[model samples]
Target: MVSIAQGTFRTVLLTPEGRLLDCRASSVLLPSHDGMIGILRNHAPMLCELQKGIIQVKNIPDRKNAYYLIDGGFARISLNHLTILAYEVITFEGMDREQAERTAALAKESVATKGSFVSNFDEEIDPDRAAFIVKLAHLSEIGND
Candidate 1:
């Protein structure tokens, strides 16, 4: 028999739409408004507003490290607990390949029309959110049929 160095902790990622993810993990990295934040075993209490970006989980005894692209929202971490309340989340694993590809294609076409996407431009829309969508679109392009 073998004893693991650490016990796995539970992690639940939810959105108003539904439960995006729920599982256990040893650590998680979240992209917050300020920057990337890391959560690990017995982490101190924290509450943060999230930005459009990715959430990464690492080393769940029974689960794999998970990656999710999330829209702006909020997150909380306390003791060994971590919860993310996002308005929208696109988990790489949960996405339908075809749908993802279509989304990417659409965004790409829009950017192509604009020349470079104007990542620094500010409009009625949040540029950060648009950039995040672009990133997801790019990922979808990887082996994207």
Candidate 2:
């Protein structure tokens, strides 16, 4: 395995709503459909479907390591530029730790409620989605702090 520890790349994270993050990073780790994949500058061109999880941007020029929770999407990597087109994004921009904690609490409650309510035999809470939400909440709390 090759180790990528130097250089930078342009990273753009967007959703149907709007652009959530646009920055240059030294490295980025995203949750792919299969598992976590890390991208570094001059990486080989590739495209993959993203999973519901956290996206970590590391070694930014002018900010702390940033994190975003994505529901699902696709990532395109080419020529040292990585673009992420996500379906939904949960951000902690300007959110305080207290607020994030509350959001996490609400997410837990939602998961519990959905799991307990079994209305319509064909409809039930998706375990993957629920787990994703829980993970998102946890990430948000960490990011806010």
- Predicted structure with the largest TM-score when compared to the true one: 2
Candidate 2's residue-wise lDDT over 84-110, tens digit each? 999757666666766666655555665
Residue pairs in candidate 2 whose N, alpha carbon or C atoms collide under 3 angstroms: none
lDDT of 2: 0.75
Q: Which 10-residue span in candidate 2 carries the lowest summed lDDT?
A: 116-125
Give each model a TM-score: 0.69, 0.76
lDDT of each: 0.67, 0.75
Q: Give a tens-digit lDDT track for model 1, residues 1-77.
A: 64442565678898888887788888788888999988777776889998878787788676556777776788887
49, model 1: CA deviation in Å?
A: 1.6
Considering every candidate listed, which one attains the maximal lDDT? 2
Stretches of model 1 off by over 4 angstroms after superposition: 1-7, 62-64, 115-130, 137-141
Candidate 2 TM-score, C-alpha based? 0.76
Clashing pairs in 1: none
